[model samples]
Target: MSHRAALGTLAIGGNPLVSRRVLSSVGEWGGARVGARGAGLSTSMASAEELRLVARIATGDEAALRQLYARYGSLVYSIAVRVTGDRCAAEDVAQQVFIRVWERPAGFDPERGSLRTWLATLAHSRAVDHVRREQACHRREQRQLPGAPSDVEEVATSSAVAERVGRAVDALPDDQRVAVLLAYYDARTYREVAAELDIPEGTAKSRLRLGLRRIARCLEQEGLGAWT
Candidate 1:
């Protein structure tokens, strides 16, 4: 796959182009878990208020956008930082998150969860995309070397391993997938994942552990053992 195409298939996929897919996946997953998870966010009852703000923003209300930012800006920035590990990248991710919200406030569904959690999810996804792009650039530069047989072999092996891992992650159940994504890719702790997902700590740990074990088995079956 081309580097552009591989973004969506990889675990590190993140970019405005793929944000809709990530949002849709997380929104659907959140909707499904509502009854079982009961608003896996810090503030359960604030979604209604947030929904009003989103509706206002949807109608070209700039003040509403500012208000929404005021409430969750810090949270969004922190999530970006966790995923990108650089202040500049985090700032860019934060900007993308707000720009996305301004352009499509309806994307944040009150039924799925609070605006905070939804935006945070988007922020993390975008940050991951930035990291992926940087890594891809580095890969491209390394591939420019002339007649490096071992480097070519290593790159091919790495790509195959990444593809296998991505497929395995894609096959995971929604809840487990989100937990693993947040915990492993987003650099969130189990406690943070549980808090963000509005589940108990023990449940978060269980899902991550079980999900990772399944991924390992899948990778091993696929003859990808570096991680497994």
Candidate 2:
């Protein structure tokens, strides 16, 4: 199953999905510090502490991994949310960041930079990657549309569709929602969607078909079928 599908199944099984709110309220990351001198000391302490945590994690200490997550999870999730502008995608990005750190503690080089900076850089890169992929998919979708409408028509239609379709997207199941976002909304071809999502091309096609059908049904139910 797709990543979103798996996450949805887990949610159905009463497993909580980690999100920005979850990360923010997760653990105390050394509380608050005020003043320039105090801020500098906090930075120094965090860097030193993070380095130690990385070392411990590399040595198979699970507690150190938890500490690392507590320290950087909120910042990572915030960066992702800011860049992606989509909570679901941001949540996926945040989870991937911590998972990467957990599996490859040595990826962070203390001599090169502090752990926070490293994680921030990784988060930014991932979010940007997500944006570019979505843009590419959107362009492809536009290319396949019946024809280019007049400039004024295009502008007005885009506004209406974006607002209406966004609500429709939210109502879809996790797997279908993600596929629709990447395909019709983002404009990815089935092959491109399959490649990006690491799914078989046939599966991507099936998901898109199912998702679009559901979206159409939703729009119709909401009396927006004519708009679609």
Best candidate according to TM-score: 1
Model 2, poorest ten-residue lDDT window?
A: 32-41
Off by over 4 Å in 2: 1-43, 140-228
lDDT: which candidate is best? 1
Counted clashes in each candidate structure = 3, 3
TM-score of each: 0.47, 0.45
Model 2 CA lDDT for position 221: 85
Candidate 2 TM-score to native: 0.45
Q: In model 1, what is the error at residue 180, expressed in angstroms?
A: 4.2
lDDT of 2 by residue, 19-106 (tens): 2223344333223111111222234336566777888867756566566665556667666765676767776666567656655777
Model 2, position 226: C-alpha lDDT score? 33
**Global lDDT scores for all candidate models:** 0.61, 0.58
Where is the poorest 10-residue window by lDDT in model 1?
143-152
